[model samples]
Target chain A: GAGVSQSPRYKVAKRGQDVALRCDPISGHVSLFWYQQALGQGPEFLTYFQNEAQLDKSGLPSDRFFAERPEGSVSTLKIQRTQQEDSAVYLCASSLGASAGGNIQYFGAGTRLSVL
Target chain B: AQTVTQSQPEMSVQEAETVTLSCTYDTSESDYYLFWYKQPPSRQMILVIRQEAYKQQNATENRFSVNFQKAAKSFSLKISDSQLGDAAMYFCAYWGGANSKLTFGKGITLSVRP
Candidate 1:
């Protein structure tokens, strides 16, 4: 793909329902990142991945938030028991590995999740 | 922990005019990277420009240029001959080398009046 792609551009989930957002990064990008953005705030880092390894999950707000990059090419962010506060835009970004300096990150359009 | 700050919540500039957006950061690290990203109505994050803290010379991309002052830990973006399309939410971000997360400011909403 020419750029990072995210599925379900818009989603509405009832409170307590689970939602899964997917990301397809540019082919061969070794590093992947997930961020959460509220209505008027900047994107906040949630997790990071290097290949198939989930190196950083420190930013996840609570135990309900989970992310995985199984094959290192595609990733998924699953939210369990979604709450009204969970409504936000989920962004996915990819970058070259450390050897490339990881200076630039390409981002997806993001999935807008609405929890009622 | 590093933090980026953008004081202006909203700014307005007329088309063809020049406008400057201010940003300040606090970090103990000597070396790092600064970036400016634009998010329009479509909500896709786009890289506008980047500056390496180790370099004295500022970065310029077409009409976008930055005035980076390492001593003050300030990185400001100057848009020359602004266009209507330039209207968007602009963010200032920071990253410290590899394995580091990018910290972003709250963002400034830029409005270009024709």
Candidate 2:
């Protein structure tokens, strides 16, 4: 599909292990975003990237949660020393431009991570 | 900080009938955007509709429409001729435009009874 692509639709990790989730945004998209949605809850912003520059990452819960988009086209959300609280569905979205309506995001089927 | 509220945790509607899902928001900024997103079991967040705060007229897309009351800080979605496909988790979101992030409300699960 032409939409955003997230790898490892489901991941199960042991406590204290490290896991990485990948997201491939749509072609020509200038902005990309990451969100975490816990069970029965809405997605909360995690981070954002604009053409290889990580513009904002304040939404990350802790230092254990890190995200990067070195190439601007692909992004990775890595959680170190995972805890039970780290379990959630991570979603990736991309938009074409930076304007208001232009920032309407298209999302990918998120990666559901379970920390046991 | 902007906050969205979806007080209803779940709702059900009969197929071919009409239903309304309520949403309210709190924001100090006058210029912003409101959106409705649907997430099925597949976990894909699909944009259903959007309304700009500056526009006084309500926004409608096909069978979906919104009663956007800016003064009351209320934005509710109305689905006409509901179908089984409409069964999903619906989220109301607010975007301030300054930040490239969306503040979403705890979603409401909607079921379409056939």
TM-score between candidate 1 and the true structure? 0.97
DockQ of each: 0.63, 0.73
In the order shown, the candidates' Cα RMSDs to the true structure are: 1.2, 1.0
- Candidate 2: where are CA atoms >4 Å away? A99-101
lDDT string for model 1 (B22-66, tens) is 999998888888999999989999999999889999999999999
Clashes of each: 0, 0
Worst 10 residues of 1 chain B by lDDT: B94-103
TM-score of 2: 0.98
Estimate the lDDT of model 1: 0.92
lDDT tens digits by residue: candidate 2, A3-82: 99999999999999999999999999999999999999999999888888988888999999989888768899999999
Stretches > 4 Å off in candidate 1:
A99-102, B97-99
Tens-digit lDDT string for candidate 2 (B1-114): 789999999999999999999999999998999999999999999999999999999999999999999999999999999999999999999998587799999999999999
